[model samples]
Target: MTQYEVTETSDVKGENCPMPVVKTKQTIDQLAEDDVLEVLATDSGSVSDIAGWADTTEGVELVDQEGDGDVYKHYVRKTE
Candidate 1:
């Protein structure tokens, strides 16, 4: 498995729909380039929403993702 030294974390566990993605974009914007942001979310749809959002967003990279039970954790590296 890949290990990341997360510099920041956003716990949007209970948020649904655009909340997770919104928080992720907001959080990632605050991070410096190359810094890792870890996101904890309970909404399963975030798995795809975040990924897709990151895919189209600039200055953000989806480094890793994991799903455990009802929780989804994602790692994003700021590129800009």
Candidate 2:
């Protein structure tokens, strides 16, 4: 696993599907350039959803992702 110094954390643990991606995008919007946001989600589909969102979204990077059974952690960085 890669190490990340998260600037903020967004908890959407109980959310599913588009909620995770939606919340992540919302949180990322609030972050400054180069800031990292750690998104905590319980939805298994978030792995792909978050990745795809980051890929298509400009100025945002999917830094890393970690999964431990029920919890999914996504690190997103804002780059201007």
Candidate 3:
């Protein structure tokens, strides 16, 4: 995966499933095309939720994803 510079970051740690995806969507919206948004979440469900959201969303791309300790790091890129 290409390493992307995070133009925006949203930390939804301790939040539930929907909050991670919801906050990611909001943060992604604040980014411009091709900009990367890094989301930090502790909810295990967020791994799938954010990935699914990026899959279903038209302009968001799930560029990278990994787990660090209890934190799930999701890298989403805003695309045209």
Candidate with top TM-score is 3
In the order shown, what is each candidate's alpha-carbon RMSD?
1.1, 1.3, 0.8
Estimate every model's Cα lDDT from 0 to 1.
Answer: 0.92, 0.92, 0.90
Model 1, span 1-80: residue lDDT tens: 65669999999988999999999888888889989999999999999999999899989889999998999999999988
RMSD of 3: 0.8
Q: Candidate 3: which stretches are off by over 4 Å? A: none
TM-score of each: 0.94, 0.93, 0.95
Weakest 10 consecutive residues of candidate 1 by summed lDDT: 1-10
lDDT of 2 by residue, 1-80 (tens): 65568999999999988999999988898889999999999999999999999999999999999897899999999987
Off by over 4 Å in 1: 1-3
What is residue 13's positional error in candidate 2, in angstroms? 0.4
State, as a TM-score between 0 and 1, how close model 3 is to the true structure: 0.95
**In model 3, how large is the Cα lDDT of residue 63?**
95
